[model samples]
Each structure stands twice: as structure tokens, then as C-alpha cells.
Target: MSEQNASAAVNIDITRIMEMIPHRYPILLVDRILEFVPNERAVGLKNVTFNEPHFQGHFPRFPVMPGVLIVEAMAQTAAIMVVQTLGKEAEGKLVYFMTIDEARFRKPVVPGDSLHIHVQKTKQRGPVWKFKGEAMVGDTLCAEAEFSAMIMDN
Candidate 1:
């Protein structure tokens, strides 16, 4: 992490986030980053809607957001934390999920709900980082998980 990001409050706009992470439409889970604490934590936002492609097969009629997607969103949020912590040096770097522990789905996430994803760094070693993540829709916890990932330059 750079000294500027370490001492200063960190925040990244959509354009910069796009340049740092390679995920795109339908797959790019985070819409924008709300806050970053360098190597500590990051908050991200995702506006869920009925128009999302996953709704087609995830459920044809009832249309409840899949649990896996919620977990995926949390993972993406972690990626943002990791990337920003590395001071955007992760450009062209690939982050692969190594493990997910204590994952729990507390409630059903649905269309039209805005997801607030929060991820905090717990530890880091070499290229591996561990994080705790949670997904909430309006104050109610929808899902959460503790996961690890390995960062490698692509």
C-alpha cells in the first residue's frame, strides 16, 4: 500500500474500479465502492433488480436471489478490499478464492433490494489474504462468509 492511501482516507470511483478489476456486466457484482481503509476494510454497493440475467434460471417464477450469488458478491467486495489495499497494483492480477468458511445464509435476497457488502481483512501472508464478509439488504443480514484468496499477477 502506498503512503498516501495508508495515511489518507481511501475511496475509488467506478472508472478506477473498472480499470483495477476485470469483471464486467452481469458478472461485475460491485457497482461502486463507498469507503476503503487501505489494508483494513472496504464497503461496496450493488443495486439488485429483476432485470438481472441470473433471475432467468435461478428461479423462473419465485425469483429469489441465489445464495451463491450473495456469496459471490461478498467475494467481489473482498476483491475490492484486496485490490485497493495493494494500491491498485493488482492491475491485471487475478485473485482466486482459496476457501470459504462459516458461510451462512440468513435471509432471502430478492429483486429491487440494494445489497450492502462489507469486507474486512483479517490476515495477510505473502500473496494470500483472509477476510470476513457480510451481505445485508436494508439492516437485515442476508448472507456472510469468511474466505481466503491468492493474488497472482496475470
Candidate 2:
């Protein structure tokens, strides 16, 4: 890890994450943030389990985590970075997806997997920010995407 990343590494639990973004259970994909670099980047984790609602209807025999939700996890990671960058005043503010590009699902994510989400800021213009994100299971890349979003008040 670079000096910046090493200096910024900090643990953010679900409660703090909830205070930063407006997502709740079922929709709140990120379980914890392992590393955060304010405006630069963030690394988060999502523990995939069989109890999630989508698994029941998605595929009972082979419950694969939806690709879209993985992307959403990436977005949520980016949102946390945004909020951290902007400070306490930005808490509870909403981050809305403006675009998702070059999304690719390389491997299927299943229950009992620990999905690690990594997101880095690519650009920023006022409230709008662009990011590149990757979802990984151990060393294997499960999904990746480039996306942009805007922060707004409630």
C-alpha cells in the first residue's frame, strides 16, 4: 500500500456507515469499510449469506449474488468516501448514481463469500464525482465498473 493509503486506513463499522448514507437493511450492501482515504479511495466488505431476500427467488438451487447488487456495493463504498471527504455536514446526504459504465461480471459471487469492494475516485466536479470500482473474492475479481454519482441534500 502507498503512504496515503496506509495513513488513511481506518475501520468504519455499520453504524457509522449508516450515519453517512441513507441505506438500511436489505439495501445496505456494505457491511464494513476496511480502508478509507477521504476523497481518494475506499475499500469495503460485504459478507454474502443465504439469508438475504434475493436469494430465495434469484435461484434456489444455486444462489448467486446479483451483479447489480455487487455494483451497488461498489457505489455504496464510493458514497462513504464522498461523505468522509465532505465531513460531518455531508452526513445523511444522498448520493445518486448518474452513470455506470464498463461494468463486467467476471465471476459469480455466492453465499459464504467475503466480497471485498474497492473504489477509487477518478474525477470530481462540485457535487458530481466519478469512480472506478472492483469487487473481489480473495484474489479473484468478481465484478468491476466505472460509475459517476452526485451528492444531494435530503
Candidate 3:
């Protein structure tokens, strides 16, 4: 098999994700992608740190990771799944979250915690894709949502 086939068959790292997705610093919520199964499922990681851009305005003294950013992290992970599945064709394309449904925040995410994000593709029709996403830290669930997005060329 080729390198592309191997990537599709196994877990992907930060470098591979960076090559597919256009998100950069301050916006790239996912730190690394652990596993991907084409259109079926994917796992990603985000390391919460005190130095993140949101920490400055989210709180002054007791900084807590914002729920929206957490959701964005999940979205980024989902984007990785789609991009990896589509391969090089995903470059220069933007994946916009069309809807966020059934979102639940169970716990507060703070600095020094490595959030494990898991996403599974629930459905796909033409340009739109629906995903079920969850974020966890150890045994505790931090956030979860069912969202949809449409891929657009940028």
C-alpha cells in the first residue's frame, strides 16, 4: 500500500492533520489526532493550557476553558475525520458547523487537562455531514453534542 493508504488505515498525528486542515494557532483546537476510520469514527486530543487565547478573556483570576471553544475542538476533530477521508481534496475547504443539537456540558475544563475528543459520523448526504462528538478527561465527560456541517471550498 501507499503512504496515503497507510494514513487512512491507521491513527494520524498532528503533522498529518496540519497538512489537511487549514486552522492555525489560536483557532486550531485539536493538538493531535489519535485514530481515524474514514467516515466511521475518529479520536482527537486537545491540551488545555493557561496560555491559550481564550484564557485571557474567559476569566481574570480563575480561568476556565470556555464551552464554545470546547465545542470548536470537537468540530476540529470532526473536520480531521472528513479531511482525512477525502484526502488531499480537503485542502482549502472550510467545514462550517450548520447546527449544534443535543449539546451537554458535564464538567468544567481547566488548564493542564488533556481533553480526549471522540467523533463519529452519523450520516452524510451530499455536502453535509452529521457527527456525534464527545469530550472526556479520564473517566469524566466534559462535553458532548450532535452537530452538522457543510464542506465548502475556500
Candidate 4:
């Protein structure tokens, strides 16, 4: 990230994340925001655990966090960036997926991994925004995708 961008980002915890988005419990994939720079980019955290609901059937013997959920986590992080950019104007609005592209899983995200999600804005036209994202476990890449979402009235 450039110095100009870095200067604008602010860190947020789970309590503030809950205040920013509507997800909760097992569905709230993001644990924290390490960097959030309004319209530019965001970095999120997810501490994977064995107790997650997906582990029950995702694989009985060897469990792995589903690739789709990782994408969702990235999307949620991007959604927070959008909300943070828009401030109070974003309240009561919902971020809905419009498209997902170039999605790939480089490595399986397993239990006890700490997922670091990085998302950057590609474009924004009206209520629709496009973003590219990567999910990683430390320095190892776990998954990546480019997706679009429409922020609409809830």
C-alpha cells in the first residue's frame, strides 16, 4: 500500500465489525479489520477454528474451511470498506453479490489457520462496486477472486 493510502486506514475490532455489518455468530466470517481505507482497500482477519459449523460435514475425518466461505469473508471485508467509505449513508443498506470471477483455491484452509484477507477496489459505478481479493494463511496464499456487489436498500 502507498503511504497516502496507509495514512487513511483505521483498525477495527470484532465489536465494531458487528456494528458495521449485519452478520453474526457462525455466519460472521470476519474477526477483525487490520486495515480499512474507505474506498481504496481493506485487510481482514479470520481465526479459523475446529468448532466451526462447516467442519461437521465439510469433511468428517479431515476438515477444511470451504473455499466459498473464504470468498464470502473477502466479500464481507470489501463490504465493510464500502460501508466505512460511505459512513452513515451506508446504514440499512445490504451488500449483495452480483458476480464472482477468477476464483481459485491455491491451498486448503484448514482448522486453526488464521486467514488474512486483502481486498482492493477496482471500480465503483453508482451502487455497484468491483473488487479483487486474496485470502492467505500467513505468507501462503489460500484463495483469491474478483467479485462485484451491489449495495441496495434493505
Candidate 5:
């Protein structure tokens, strides 16, 4: 994708998202990319449900989405943006988390909640990129964090 095209709003479905990232099955937290602006930012959506594997062990009577998983969803959103910015050549590359700072969980995310993950690039050098992300359910802020990741050939 060119700079011109990158600037335009883009919607990525589950199939395309699968091609860009390696996460799958129960771990593929992001269900779709609602909007993507290459190097700038991306907004992804995850539809939480009771059928998720974690809910069985996380809490049987009162299921709640794990905080760590929420952060992972944010990271996944960032990774998708990174891959889109780098183009097809970087597809299937591995993005490993280097650091997670100032992470906070404000509200419990339950099943039926639509998690909107907003991630913006803060800094980038070589293959390492820093991002600030927020997980929101409608207008409610559920969680947020600042993190960095290194993208490398798989």
C-alpha cells in the first residue's frame, strides 16, 4: 500500500486479518479492523461471547474477559497496522512484545460486549514500534496501556 492509499480509511475483514497476523482460534482476539491508517493508527473490533474458552476457567458463574487478553487485543490491533504499513512483504511476520507500561483496567468486560480497540503509533525506529492503546466498550473505557513490539521475520 502506498502512502496515498494508506491515508485512506480501510476496512479489513477476518480473512485479511488472518493473512496479516499469526494469531488464530481462541487467541485471535480481533475479529475485524473497522478502520486503519497505516503508520498512524487503527481501530479493531472484538465481539466477546460466553463461548470463549477462557470463560470456562476464568469464571464459571460470573465470566469476565481477562485483563491480559484485553491488552493482547490492543497489541493485535497495533500489529495489524504495522503489517499494513509495511505492505505484503511483511505479512506473517512475528511481532513480539518488548514492554508493557502503565496498563490499567478500568471496567470489567463481560460477554456480549463489543470491544473497540484503538491503537496509535507513538514512536518507531527500525522494526520496533511503540503504541498507546485503549480498549473501549461503547463510550466506556475498559482498559488502556502503552507498549512496544519488535517485528521480525517468522
Candidate 6:
């Protein structure tokens, strides 16, 4: 971990997350970063709610958060890991999806559940970053995946 990252804040609120990445409103999935170990690992959080627009169409009878959105949450968490690690130098950069492997949605995520997104850095080279992420609600595993992304100036 870089010196700056080593001393990085562990708790990151939504306002701070918004400054890190270019996401807002309905599309911004992560609500807070619960744990950040700079370049090594990060745990992001999203409070699933019925008011979300996707739930309206995902299922009328039994609303469920889409699996694809879970993966997007993981991607965003990984991006924050990079941004937090590099600090201000990473401000104007964006992380783009390169690949997603071994993705699996084990259970449905519903409203009233707090989705815990845990991601760890598996590898990094230049602007490329690889990670393994898992989404969970309480003790149940909701999703898991291995993914890669590239950080580029926007």
C-alpha cells in the first residue's frame, strides 16, 4: 500500500464516494464505503429499498434487485479502492470494465436488506486492476465474481 493509502480514512460517506467517482442519483449504487484498506481491500454498502426505480419493473409480485446491478456495485467498490489508494492523483480518472469472470448470483436481494459488497485486489499493473468481490445480506451469500477494470483519465 502506498503511504497515502496506508493513512487513508476507513469510513467513507456518500458525499466522499461521489467525489471519487462520477456516479449520481438513480445509477449510483454504493451508498457508503464501510471499510477501506487502501489498495488491498474495501467493503462497500448499499441499502436496498423498494423506492428504487429498478424494483418497479424487476418483479411486480416479488421485487428483487437485479444480479447485474450487484456486479456493478462490486465494480464501483473496486474503483473506489483504486481511487482511495492513489488519493488526489486519481481524482479525474475513471475505471472501466475490462472483464468479468466466474460471476454467480446465489440468492435474491430484496428491499430492507443491506447489501455488503466486499472486494479485494487480486492484481494490479499500471492502470489495470483485478479483483474478487462478494455480495452478502446478513449471513447469506447473494453474489460473487472476479472482475478486472482499467483506470483512465476522463
Evaluate all candidate structures by whole-model CA lDDT and list the values in order. 0.84, 0.95, 0.88, 0.92, 0.95, 0.93
Cα-based TM-score, every candidate:
0.89, 0.96, 0.90, 0.95, 0.94, 0.93
lDDT per residue, candidate 6, 1-154, as tens digits?
6675563346799999999999888989999998888688999999999999998999989999999999999999999889988999998699999999999999999999999999999999999999999999998999999999999999
Model 6: ten consecutive residues of lowest lDDT: 1-10
lDDT of 5 by residue, 36-122 (tens): 876899999999999999999889999999999999999999999999999999998999999999999999999999999999999
- lDDT computed for candidate 4: 0.92
Residue pairs that clash (backbone atoms under 3 angstroms), model 1: none
Ten residues in a row with the worst lDDT in model 2? 1-10
Which stretches in model 1 have alpha-carbon errors above 4 Å? Answer: 1-11
Which has the greatest TM-score? Answer: 2
lDDT of 4 by residue, 2-108 (tens): 86667454668898888888899989999988887778899999999999999999998999999999999999999998998899889668999999999999999
Q: Rank the candidates by TM-score, best first.
A: 2, 4, 5, 6, 3, 1
Off by over 4 Å in 3: 1-11
TM-score: the better of candidates 2 and 4: 2
Cα misplacement distance, residue 119 of candidate 4 (Å): 0.4
Clashing pairs in 6: none
Q: Write down the TM-score for model 3.
A: 0.90
